[model samples]
Target: MTLNLFSQFASPYLLGVPLIFVASISPWLLLPSPANRWMPNRLIAIQTWFSKTFTKQIFSPIGPLGHKWALILTSLMAFLLTINLLGLLPYTFTPTTQLSMNLGMAIPFWLATVLIGFRNQPTASLGHFLPEGTPTPLIPILIIIETISLFIRPMALGVRLTANLTAGHLLIQLISTATLALLFSSPLVSSLTFITLLLLTILEIAVAMIQAYVFILLLSLYLQENT
Candidate 1:
């Protein structure tokens, strides 16, 4: 029974093709494209406004040099936001819940910031490893510790996203299963559980949005430091 519950996380296959691949890319189609008319429809307009607002907020802390990432970062935010929200619907798979996929995204973006730091300011980048005025005795140990922390950033990003979504989904599943089991035994308790499920679902929606924003916001901060 526990295995059955976790089976939901397994990638579905059809004729030996992974459907998760399709699910990952499907969100792109949901995004509105530019209209031929001078005035776009409401959907396009809303998308534009949201993108602009998010871009401004995210990049404001970053210097002008970091603004170059606005397009890719904004698109990533939209993609993640759409995927997370869509996954909340019944019978849908969330790609972000997979550590592999999350890491795939986190590593590249994180590496880009690190590489930018190395390219633009190599001294500052290496200086991050060893602080000023450190005693000679502890210098090597601090460098090792700081280096480990630096490398851990991408893993943290990926695990944080995967863990949050996984926990939320698991809780929802457990509560929902209990609710269904109690439905035939005690309608009152079942109804209360259902109410709790409803509230949890709403909270998950907010979490979905917030997680996406946080991912990008952290990336922007990394860029800010490098710039």
Candidate 2:
């Protein structure tokens, strides 16, 4: 449980970065058509018939944008959540618990927000940073605050994810160490520690899902606000 910078750097954490990158961005490359334009009605029909016949087939309830978006978001979530959970396993590292990896994901998302907003509404997107109805004296302060808030999005996103994953991992490690230490020192204490670690493992699974949900929810909210 001693913090070892070199140990972390030497682990497979670095490799997860590219894996996550590919998982997040590969869908765009594979699916060349715009989400809005890509229709799978024929495919859907085939799937629906299969579902009806087998009673164990898959069905897509949403349109192309919704489905593609779901796939993209799920891919991201899977990579990050898997990385986060990996730390629980012996000899594995969680890349998402690292600041660099979290920032890599967050910064791109922030840039995506800006690019999407501007692309959707070239002139009006500026209005998001500077609202129309504002008091004359307060305009400067509002603009400054808005600008700061805009910049803080990525910072918040990165810090929130990294902090959550890091804290969870640290807590698990602490409990695990405590359990090991107590095994020789006190059986009762060791048993309690084991129980706590078990409970925490379950909680971490929920945390993974919650974190994924939060990231995608906030992302969608940002998109909705701008567009």
Candidate 3:
């Protein structure tokens, strides 16, 4: 029996819903257990040592915040990385490649950065929407531009991942389908389609990794800006 790739289910929200919960509650999960309440010092020592060694090796210039950031970023990366890679598996879906899922992740990160910036520097956060050295007459226009640009981040993130993955998937499916059809009708066309599909599959793997890294990199940049 032949498999129907298009018949498979691939809902972005369904895949991303759990990721949202995991990201939201990760900090609490990392807190020390109640049994170790009396040994707070010990826990702190362990965490400090781990942070020093790991942070130094992985994210040198960032220091202690690097450790916390690493944990947060890794969690996000793992979730997205898994979804992106899983799409290559038979009968599985890649939620990270979906616009809804990518936007769901990016929007929260953008909002979190904005909220953090506001909490850290309320007045300055608004000022950030304006160009640094603009004249008074052009400040309003610059602010409008900046505001639109700021809001566009999530949209851009969504479109980038979604379009790349969806396009790749469609290409693969077309090649495979055409190959099978040609194999029964014309051998030469079948061979070419097969080769094309093979190359596209390899390219898609690279695309998956690049998309995941890009997502995490943008998130890190946003966090750093707020900090």
Candidate 4:
């Protein structure tokens, strides 16, 4: 029974092939393509506006050096946002919920920022591992601690997204299954459970959006540090 409850998190397979890629890429395919006309249609227009607005809000606080990443970061934000929201649908699987997939993204982006910092300003990068005016004895300890913290950032990013989405999905499944079970036995209780499920679904939607934003925002913050 416990294993059955967690079966949703398992990747769906057909004919011995995983459908994770299809699930991830389908959202992008559903997006509206731009027309050759001077003005885009309403869907495209809204997409453009949202992308521009998000890019501005995210990059406004970043330094000029970080501004160079605007396009890549913005696209990543959009991709994450789309996949997360789509995954909330009844039959869809969220690729972001997979820790392996999330880590794949987190590591490269975080490493890139670190590499950039090292290339452009090695002193500043290394300086992050040790603070100024450190006491002689604690200096080594502090440096080791800071270095560990630095390496932990990417794992934190990946685990945060994975854990949040996984927990939400589990709760939703639990409530939904309960609601179904109680329907015939107790309509009133089932109705209440159903209402709670609705509210939970709405909150999950917000969480899905926010988690994506937070992921990119943290990456941008990392970029800001290195830049």
Best by TM-score: 1
TM-score sort, best first: 1, 4, 3, 2
lDDT of 1 at 86: 87
RMSD of each: 0.9, 8.0, 7.6, 1.0
What tens-digit string does per-residue lDDT give for candidate 1 at 42-149?
Answer: 999999999899888888888888999999999999999999998898998998999999999999999999999999999999999999999999999999999999
Worst 10 residues of 4 by lDDT: 26-35
Candidate closer to the true structure by lDDT (higher is better), 1 or 2: 1
Q: For candidate 3, write residues 15-94 as lDDT tens digits.
A: 54744444334444554443545455776666556545643444544434434678666656645655677678765556
**lDDT score at residue 120, model 3, on the 0-100 scale:** 70
Model 1, C-alpha of 128: deviation from truth (Å): 0.7
Off by over 4 Å in 2: 1-71
* lDDT digits (tens) for residues 1-227 of candidate 4: 78987788888988988989898888778777778899788999998899889989998888899999998998888889899998899887888889999999999999999999999889999999888889999999999999999999999999999999999999999999999999999999999999999999999999999999999999999998998
lDDT of 2 by residue, 1-227 (tens): 25553344233436455444443444345333323445556645554453344221111333233333444555565455555555556766566666777788788877786787788677887786678888899888988999899889988888888778767777777788789989988999899889999999899878876775577666655655555
**Positional deviation of residue 187's Cα in model 4 after best superposition, in angstroms:** 0.9
Question: What TM-score goes with each of the models?
Answer: 0.98, 0.70, 0.72, 0.97
lDDT of each: 0.92, 0.64, 0.70, 0.92
